[model samples]
Target: MQLLILLQLTIYFALVLSIRPRQCPKGLNDANTPRCVAMDGISDVEKNECRSAKHCCIGRNGYCYALPRKVVPTIDPDKTNEEMLSDAKDIMRSIKGGARFLNIGPFPSALLPYGGEDPYPGFPRLPAFVCHKRPRFPDNCDMEDKKALRYTRNPPLNIPYCIRIPCDPDLPELDESRTKCREMPGCFFDVQLRDYRKKFGHSVMAGVPVCQLAIRNKVFLEEARKVKDKTGEWTPYLNECLLDTFDEIIRTNHEGCKTLEMLEYFKHKPKIAGWKGIKEYDCYLIAGCWMTKKCYYPVDVNNVTVSASPTEHDDKIPSALYYGRPPCQKFDDKNAKSAIESYHSCLVSGCKLDKHAQNSYYNYLFDFGKSMDPSDHWVFWRLVESGKYGAHNLDEYNLLPKHDVTVTPFSLVFNYPAKPGESNLIDELLRPGSSSLLDMIKTGSGLQVPPAHQNIRDRFLEDLQGIQTPCSTTFTSFGARPCGPPRYKPTGVPNHCPYRPIEDKDLKPLRGSFEGCCDITLCYHPKEEIPNARSGAATYYSTWSYWTECSATCGKGNKKRWRRCIGMDQSQCTGRTTENESCEIVPCSSWNKWSRWSKCSLTCNSGVSTRTRTCKPIGGFCPGPDEEIESCNSEKCKIDRLFGPWSEWKGSCNPCGKSIYRSRECEATTCNDDDLYEIQQCPTGCGTWSSWSPFGPCTWDFFFRTCQKTRTRVCNGKNGRPTECQGNSVDVAYCIC
Candidate 1:
């Protein structure tokens, strides 16, 4: 029984050894020789040789050993439940403050007014509504007065007819419709009258009625013609008839200044129109229509009067009809304020009064107040506001000593005179006696003279050498600087007369008209001629030029000829300034010779030596070799042993159950193809089993048992299959009987 138990134990141990997973040797793998090797202090060749010997290699700082068992802790759901519940309680614990308390609130309401409402009643109240003010015109203004502010003039007056019918017996009767324009006749009349005003209006200052002059030209010519036919006292009758005809025509065809023709006709009547010679009518023609109250015309007196109460002294009058001072200027020391009031009353009455009288009054006042003090500039209604009279000023205080300074007058000094050539008025008024003529002359000199005056001056100064100097082209009638070439004749005589002779050095003497012969040598000189410019052409000087360096160093290089204007003068250099051409530089390529051969790599046969040469002038290719090589070895090298010391012996195989074996490790280099370790057979015991007994008597109730037998064999670490074991055994199984 003991032997049988020992045999069973032996077989069990062998089965455990055979079935367990195989392990590698210290310095090698299962397919290699040694079981393990040192991780550090080993050369690559040593490591490789160790691996070839079937050894397991340890990594740096680690020993080759079996892997540890995982031993993972298995979780029991019942044991962990309490701990998990505790963790959940910690996570769900309430914070110091509730979530509702920590949350932000909605935005605050906007600021409100004192009563929590707006001051204005409307919605979307705009800034303009709160701050802006509407504009309004002045009170006491009539519809016409208000409308006139924006009223523009009518289209240009087109009067396609003769202003005067020819005084001829063969002439046809005057066709009023064809000869007169009744539509806006005042506008047409103003235009016709203005033309004559420009030409002959100056006669008014001399007390010459324009109407008389108008007839004199035609009547005088007719009278001269009739003289050949022996007419007697016909001139006076002809004049009376013409005057009557004129007065009737004006009444039929016009209004406003058009009535000036009537005034002229009346003033020139056979017995009523002359003041010693001709009546210097103290009135001017107003340029536009006038609206106002009618003047009171006394029947016996036949004159306009603003009087409220008349006394007997006012009735004592001359038999000859006489016009009084214009209502605007009728004011005296006693009546100044009352007269002004009366004038304003008339201005605002809105009645269509005779514009002729209003214009006459305005003209008289304007003309008379011109020479007064600067503050009195507004004493009269400025003619420029002919259509706008009384539109703005309605107050009693503004009536006198007025200062409507913006009004521009042609012949009157409305404000202090401005600088010469200025179109607008300035604040500086000329003093009564300060250099009036000299100022006039100076101011005139700044303006361009009329063409006739210029021609006259040019002719008188023929003896001088240049044309007129440039002067301003602006002039007022009162202040004109007539042009003059020179104020002197060739002999230097100062003559202030028209059409005098001028002696030229090379031409015939020419006659010229001038205001006065003033010495003009200072005003003109011979024109200077430019040194090199004839007829204003620019002059230039010569330039210098040179060729610059080539643009390239090898092959074809561009060379440029650069030219610069000499003396910084460019006008003379007009053609191409620079030029380019191709050029070449000599390419002298060179290289250093090869250096002496270096020492051989070996002292014996078959070694090699090398030599090298370098190219000079680095850019271009070199013509010789840069390196050379030659054999240098002189002898062969001998081989040496490369195997390491043998490792410690490993365990002998299965000593209790089979014959044992032992082994040790050594390193094997590439130089030799041999095993890295040696093995030796070890001696050990092999137990045997006895044969089993045959079945005795069969038990009636239980199956009968049979005996088994076993045998032992040397383990050569080979032939471990069941068939081999069966072949080696004397007995293999037992039977049950």
Candidate 2:
């Protein structure tokens, strides 16, 4: 009976939930909206009322509200408007088609340092350039000729923040000093300067839209932490690598001391002069501190300790943050606002800030959802809410109570020092009675104490009175004490007289202790023999004579000739007893005799003559000229000659066609005595001819009768034309014979 009642009550509750209407919040006037968007372990609905409705929005306090809507009117196009609209559509189509055009105009230069005069001056600096065409917004929702439109709105473009800002950050403005090209001190490494043009509609133009470069100075800072392990302990192996690299960096680049001027500038001025400069500055800070192993503060503020647990390590200690100083001073709940204001003011004043203030500012600029406490959470959410409502634009996001400054998480990592409590581990162990002498020694050299020295403590105490062993005597096997000689002699009987001059090959460095010898000053050194030894049986060797003449006269020459004896051992000579030397003879110089004189320079009159010679050695100095010159004789040349007309040829010098000679005298400036002559043919006079022929000799043919006719003539000359009538030939007429 109880089971049946429970089942009936469950069915009743299910029906009530299914039939119950969702109650909307007070500000909302919806009939079917759920009373609560989320239920406490009761429902599995994925979405809530505000999220489902098109004209509703969620508030920060987790309440849903209906949003007010305004109607917009449509436009009717005029002729001019229609034409412009068509052109705009065409341009948009072209841009989408990947057709690019030249966008010629002044680019925003405010983010860069101004080289020209500043027009505005004050705390809230004015923009270097204001767009006059678009009065309300300098950077409108447009780039060049194209409107800021996207192919799809569902998946937004992954554009960088500086580019997405409503007002172009690239525009020239006097708002704050910025990084200039001149201030960059090093080359860009792993740096990226993206145009953000692809995301912008007008970026297809010739000029890529300008945006802040993505600086990778943080990469260097990242490399700085690679030596640290997941546990945050800088192990021995890592220490070795870090120390060696740090030492090398310090040794090579010792310029760690930034000028006070530069430090003050960095501290007081929030704007950087150049992206490269900022990166170089970061590199300088990292290398310099790592070189000294001294960067240990949360804010990199001087003389403070910073310890952050690795991401993998849980908070073994119950603390929100770890730094040189607490994030802020202890405060009664009532004075929170005043304390916050003071902290904000300190940051603005360019004073040293506690770790919390610094982080608060960084979070304001680049919030990566890295919050450590409820207070930080509140600050981040407020900023996000402000952004959603458009109450503050992106450009004005950073214009809070504090002065504007740019910083990145990358630079902050360099300030993390070795983990807290680990730096002075050795000092803690060195406390009195903390470790035994043996343990200290073992730890010092990282080695074990030998068994022989295990009882050193007891032995040292027992022998505290004195050391009884004699200083200069050793025990013999027969139980006798052998004392060292007051003065000692060399091992073998002293080499009799003269000592040989030492050569490098024969010399041996002294080894072992130098102690009690009979002749301490000259223990192993033999004495020099008197110049002419009186006895022929003397043992010492003599000094070497002058080196013999070189065997050859040039290049590498050698000579060998000498001898010596020591203690009558002819083949056991120790030192160099022979002489050898190398020599080179300089070559002599000579000159070749002069060559035969060259032909005269000119064919007529007097002309110059020359001769030449060269020294046998090309570069050798000579006392004679390399070339000589003298005058030579030359014959006179003739000029052109003129000629006079010839006299008429003598008339027919020979009457019977005989040849005759005709000559004429001609004169010239140089050929006055010379004459001209020519040969000519003589004219032949007329020859006699016979009388006319008889008519009876005439004959007739079938075609015409024959008629008698005859004539005879004499030749005038060979020049005359030939004819039958003139050559004594007869002229005949045949008339139908």
Candidate 3:
């Protein structure tokens, strides 16, 4: 019933909770309501009002206004328009005067809300407010105070303050006392105000754009031209002249209208001159004119021929007149022939007289008279007459004569004649007896000879049968063969000393034995003989029979000599035995096998001498059929067959199949009929099993069993066994002990 009630209560509560509406703050249910409603509304109102008013709150206090519209002066109840304009003019003057102290331009009068009239009438105005004086002490006022009274306050006199006032947009806004002037009608004045402010503000405040800079480059050029013209003789003026000439040339040469423009065209052209002197200026000028098509040839100032000639007294004679000339007339009109005759006479008497005499008189007249024909001579004389023999004429005598003399008869010619007694007249007068004389000279008669020649009788000649011959012959032979001795004969051998003199001893009488000696012989023999007979035989054998035998047998048998066997006895070759035997026999077959048979053998002995073998049970005892056993020498042991109950040997042995078993022996005893004893086998093999004897005669019994104890025995229980003992000694119960 409670659960049901609880269920009903839960159902009711869930239904009620489901019907409940989600709660929210008041006035926030509408989706459009802004998260910061009040703050957003206030900000929108502030923006709209501020934008429309063109004003902003001044730091928790007053408002700042935009620059105002300029108010034109108008007539009022108490003031005339002229009076108001005058007052505004005065105010501008006063403001300008005060701005001087701040080094700023006068504030634009348009920024003022009321032109010449005070906004607040009858108020005691400070000098700064009434006159728009610059601020003097900014430290004395807060920013709001300073802004509220900006036009009235004397701002700290500084460059920045001055700049700020002129450039201050807020200043105009403050004059209007509203920000709405941003859309006002008269705002064009603000732009003018801004521009004026920019230009004049920089000038007064920062000392920049002070005034428009005046450029007068043309003025400088005009001045320079004037100076140049003033110093006309200076180098600079000369250079100007050259430049101007060049400029004019270019201007004129350019194809354009002949006006200032053309002049300007020529002004830029370069000037060229030939010489660097005063003449250069003239050249440039001329070139300039030529380029401008206004040129003419220069006037030739230095043009005239200079005449030079000799006077009558200094006239020279013609060379032909000095060499050869026709005779001169005494005065063939000295006036008419003065020029010709003066030269002719001077040349005839000048340096040519000796030359004319040698060539005309001696050379052609006498020395070579008729050798050269008369016509040729006449031609030569004509050449002389024409002064062809003048000193400068080298071709006149190219082939001249050379004189030569010779005597006719066979007479002794002497450069100087001999003395009267020096002549040999007798010899000169002798006549020949015959055209070929010979014998008369042998009679030795009428022969004229000198005293030195009288002793030479052998040279005297005799005439015999009209032939002349010497009485005694004195022969003088050269390059002739000498007479040898009578017995000497040539042996058909050359002379040993061909150049030696022939002596008397080298010649001898002839002998008959040498009549036909034509042949000769030569012989040679040894000086000693052998001492031993065997040595003699060996010698004879080597020299005669052995060599002969060798030459005849071995030499003839083969071209090569026989090779003597090394280390063999030579006497063996001479042995007398029919059975053939070698001096040192060489076996036909190899002896390697026999040699190896005689050598000792080599073999290795056993390292270890003896080895023993034995056997033992593999696991200390012989096992049953289910027990494991192993061979002693095998890598893995074997097991015997198992021989125990299932409880005693629960697990099978290894592959050998051996298991352990328990055994017991009974003691001699008498049994009581009423007493009973249970026997059990021990789990392991039994060893010296004993128990206490209560009576005199002890009874021993045997049964198949296992030893067991029944007390709290603690053992490792994971395998279902006791972990340990609790009592001192537990009673043993035999099951299969």
Candidate 4:
């Protein structure tokens, strides 16, 4: 029984590993293409490269899939109409650009959201050139990259029109009919409207839902021809426009200070939009385009009312190195609170510190009322939660005012006297601003990574838990120098509260004790003095270690092993701590010879073929490519055109008013293989359904904690079917329990 259970566990884990999504290898990552929507404005030939017979798709590294139909936001059946609409409006307006209806055009001649023949110009006549290997978009790109692509520039706002069938992946067939889609009721996905949105809207909208933009674009281009940012002249552009544009600029173009900040001043403001807003790409041509520009909106007396508010900081800000003050200090007369608030805002907004902020922070020891208790002074507690004052990182931060402390990168700072015995006594340490050496060790992590530990998990285990740094708070680390009497009060335990510093016996009384304070977190020191053994039991403090891999794999190699003495500080385990030995393995750099040629790609007049070889040691590099052309039935036969067979008319219909298209390629001797397309209308009839199939496996519905099953049948493809179905095929079954 136990054996069976272990076998089941192994099988389950194997299945889990096998289910990983199929994807192109890492080498092809850089070759990945942009979204299919990006192809909207390209010439017809490019569009053809992106389209399936009845759908659109992007070419990925090694695969492709039709673009998903834009998913609409729908309310729950439990919600009221007003509740749903009100909620949707808030969501739409909150998006970066806000929901927009760009009604651009009297449209420059016959141009439209989809261009004419050119939009699909280079499309091949081959009916089998369809791309539907997967049911979803390729998940080959990094998620961050995919997300950023959606918020990028809108495609060319117009392309030519062409008839297409719905290729919704959920529907099981690409050529599914409109009447069948209408079965669910309420705003059937209008493919024409969807196409218009792709052409008119940004490739992927950040905040707006699909349904909202589709309507706005269709309404304007189909009737009127004008565009506005916020829909009215009186409202003026909100400051949000500048902020959103700034964010977008940083994401899409990470050049200095970001060009989009300056672009926002014009794109959102009519006066500037006339020229500066032509295109984001055009901004590059103008010199110093990223220079910051603040906007001053037009004032109108009729719509404005003057009111007094708290004063905004009016100090002159230098373009370079001017920083803001820190929070939780200063309580003088006149806006002293505001200074703290301003510094707090700087922290919240992630701005740097200025001299004024530093000066305000200098009042850390300022007297707060009559209470000596730190808690009573609520003003001092005015903090940016999750962080404290001073540099959050060792690589950054200013020296404390009038202090001898010097912080180094990735380590703590400790200051002690130049001589061992001359180190600052604990009485002097009590004085403010003294840098104590007995306070920088990381006890938790030091113990985590033992001298014996060679595995990857020791120090890593502590970091993965997210401990705060500036090790004093974390480890309460402290050290006392020289073979002197214990400083402060001696404790029973080596490291404990009101901590008594232990003497560093390793430091001889040479030229008096050179006293120092420092953190030895990951790095340890030599062992302190150990008592001379009276009876010679030897203690057995260290152990032997296994040898490591050889330094070299071919001809000559040497391997070594070592043990650390953990008794008394970091030394004193007797004998030599390390040993070395020599060993070698055979060379693995040779490659195998080439193999025989395989079959050719085609059996025609001439078809290309190839053979391959390998490197002896797997994964070693070997580069070679040679070609051979096989010839068969090479005799030329004169003919105008010899047509290949017609394409299938699957998932197509005439019952609900739609045409099925088929094509044949010309394959004649010494002739072009150009395609000739044929369109056919099937006999009209209301679709019929087949009998329901046996129920599928019962699966737990996690949300409801109940077992349920499903059964489905096709419309035109299943038995008893006459034409395409007008209703959904799949149905759910209640659990028998």
Most accurate candidate by lDDT:
4
Among all windows of 10 consecutive residues in model 1, the one with the lowest summed lDDT is 100-109
User: Candidate 4: which stretches are off by over 4 Å?
Assistant: 1-563, 568-604, 610-737
Q: Give the root-mean-square deviation of each candidate in angstroms.
A: 74.4, 54.7, 80.4, 54.7
The TM-score values for the models, in the order shown, are 0.13, 0.13, 0.08, 0.16
Pick the winner on lDDT between candidates 3 and 4. Answer: 4
Query: Weakest 10 consecutive residues, lDDT, candidate 4?
Result: 528-537
Total backbone collisions, model 1: 37
- Per-residue lDDT of 1-737 in model 4, one digit per residue for the tens? 22322332233222222211223222322212222222222112233433321233323422332333222223232345566446545544432321111111111112211322223345232122222222111122233434334322221111101101122324532123334432221112334333433454432211111221111112212211221222322101111121222222322322322433332342211011102112333222111122234211121223221111111243443211121111111223244344444333232221233433433432321322112232222222222111222212212223322232222222222222222234332234334563332231222111212212222222333331222232221122222111111222212211311111223344221111111111111111111100100001011222234466678865478988665432112322346778889877645445476566666443443433566666656533344433334454454433644654565665466345466777655556443434557677666556667787887876766543434577898666334545666756876543433
lDDT of 1 by residue, 1-737 (tens): 22322332233222222212223333321111211312221212133332322112333212232212212112222334555345334433421211100001111011122333433344332221011111111111133433332312211222111111122213222112212321211211223232333554533112111111122122223433454255332222232222222222222212322332332242210001101111111001111111121111111113211111111122222211111111211222223233333333332211111222222333333333344443333323331122223312324324444343243342343332323354322222233333343343333111221222332333222211111222111222332221211221122222332222334354432211222122121111011100010111111211112344567655578877543332122444576666788887745456778799998755543667899877665544566668999896645544343443454556643433333333322222353334554656544443333343342432222221222223334323233331112223222222121
Return the candidate ranking by lDDT, descending: 4, 2, 1, 3
List, residue by residue over 299-363, the lDDT tens digit for candidate 3.
11231111111111212322221211211112122231232232222222111112222222222
The better candidate by lDDT, 1 or 2, is: 2
Q: After superposition, how far is residue 642 of candidate 4 from its true place, in Å?
A: 6.0
Q: Is candidate 1 or candidate 3 better by TM-score?
A: 1
Model 2, residue 446: C-alpha shift (Å) = 80
lDDT of 3 at 527: 8
Clash tally for model 2: 25
Candidates' lDDT values, in order?
Answer: 0.28, 0.29, 0.23, 0.30
Best by TM-score: 4
- N/CA/C clash count, model 4: 23
